[model samples]
Target chain A: MKTLWSGSREGSLLRYRAMAFTVGTGLLLLVFVGIPIQIWGHSKAVVAVVGPIHGYLYLIYLAAAFDLARRERFPISRLFVMISAGLVPFVAFIIEHRIVASLRAEERSDATAS
Target chain B: MNRESDRQVRWVAPRALVAHLLVLCFVPGCLIAGWWQATVAMSGNGLSYLYAFEWPVFAIFSVVLWWNFLHDDPDEVGGRRLRELRRDESISGERAELRSPDFRTEDEDDELRAYNDYLAQLAQRDRAKGWRSR
Candidate 1:
């Protein structure tokens, strides 16, 4: 199990994973922590602070994920799902894990065979 | 524009229809959302401004993607039927890259010699495989 933080390797997945985690945590904060406060508690502080940050992080996540997806030759449908993972809370994290595992499984024996 | 480019820009293909409908719904929807967010921001939820600005960008991005899908050629770069799946693609792609003539073959070092030998072996194996297939 390669923990996301344990390796600083510059593989294609690393940047996308980092962005996914960043955007995922930001979204979790915005939805679970921020929006609830805004709605029920009548406070905009958390949403104000976290929302823009999430917006920008989502942008970076989009670019990173798109680049990696093309490199890995993912189908268009998977690319759309990857794009949407940013907007849905916790989905980014789930998709990130899927991406990492998929890429590893792909390259495992194949990497050395070359 | 040429007739071929005209055919590509037509929006009747099933995938093209999907893209067309999405852009139809998405761009105006984003704008409306942006306007609504502007009202929310005006009412003092300062963070609503983020979405106010963001929605328009999303609308633009969708248009860009839609435009791309309209003109995409399945065999061309960025035009490969992106969602089309084929097993062994990863293996075949990597193999092609390894055999592509980017590496120096004639350097005097032992590694280069070995690489040249490896390339020769790959070529021989490929020729054999081609013969076998035929």
Candidate 2:
């Protein structure tokens, strides 16, 4: 069976970091920036125009997050949290910060032990 | 262990990358085309079709990518090498020790023990087969 984080640990960690950043940023931009701008500045026509794009991007974000979670062997409970973060407005950023901090701590402890 | 050669290792095939890129390119292209159609021709149905198609296609694409990611090679290059070295040394030493004169009597004793074990195994298998046949 293939091992989780099959790439170099550093590479895997960096990928996870990037995944968290992009997914978090993408969700934030959609919920905070894109949705609000569409609601305030333009017609419902504008929401019609941009909503699908945001949805597609959000799907991509979730996929990236799931990939990172699987590679990291994240616990089932934490994985649920990570997955749910994208669905809620502004939660992605918060979860991103928390996950990154936890991952960094894990890496530090692993390094110290080895 | 060639470091340069190791650097060249890639889990993803070139064809798969191209396929993924095409899907990525097509999703945006379809979205853009749908938007233009909506603006110029006022085709709401066309826009709806684009929106409907986008999610399912993207969902499948994401699943495929994650499957590939999960099946990527293990990262045990150095550890595997060390394991092989240790295994070889242990096997060779065992062989050398087994060749000594004192080991001859032990080997005969082991062979007698193995004969008894084999008889026991055969009897167990026969009993299992008999039960199955019944």
| TM-score of each model, in listed order | 0.64, 0.43
**Local lDDT at B47 for model 2:** 47
For each candidate in turn, give its C-alpha RMSD to the true structure in angstroms.
13.4, 15.7
How far in Å is the alpha carbon of B98 misplaced in model 1? Answer: 27
Per-residue lDDT of A1-114 in model 2, one digit per residue for the tens? 133346655555455555556656665666676667777876455456566666666665655666666566553345557667777766776777777665564455446446
Q: Best-fitting candidate, measured by lDDT?
A: 1
For residues B20-130, what per-residue lDDT tens digits would candidate 2 score against the true structure?
Answer: 675677567656765554565455454465566555555465456444433434454334334434444444455446644543244457676787567556544543431
Candidate 1 displacement at residue A6 in angstroms: 20
Deviating ranges (above 4 Å) for candidate 2: A1-6, A32-42, B1-43, B57-134
lDDT of 1 by residue, B1-134 (tens): 26437554666979889888989999999999999999999999877888899889888878877775676545553433322122234444567678666655444599777877787677556434311122
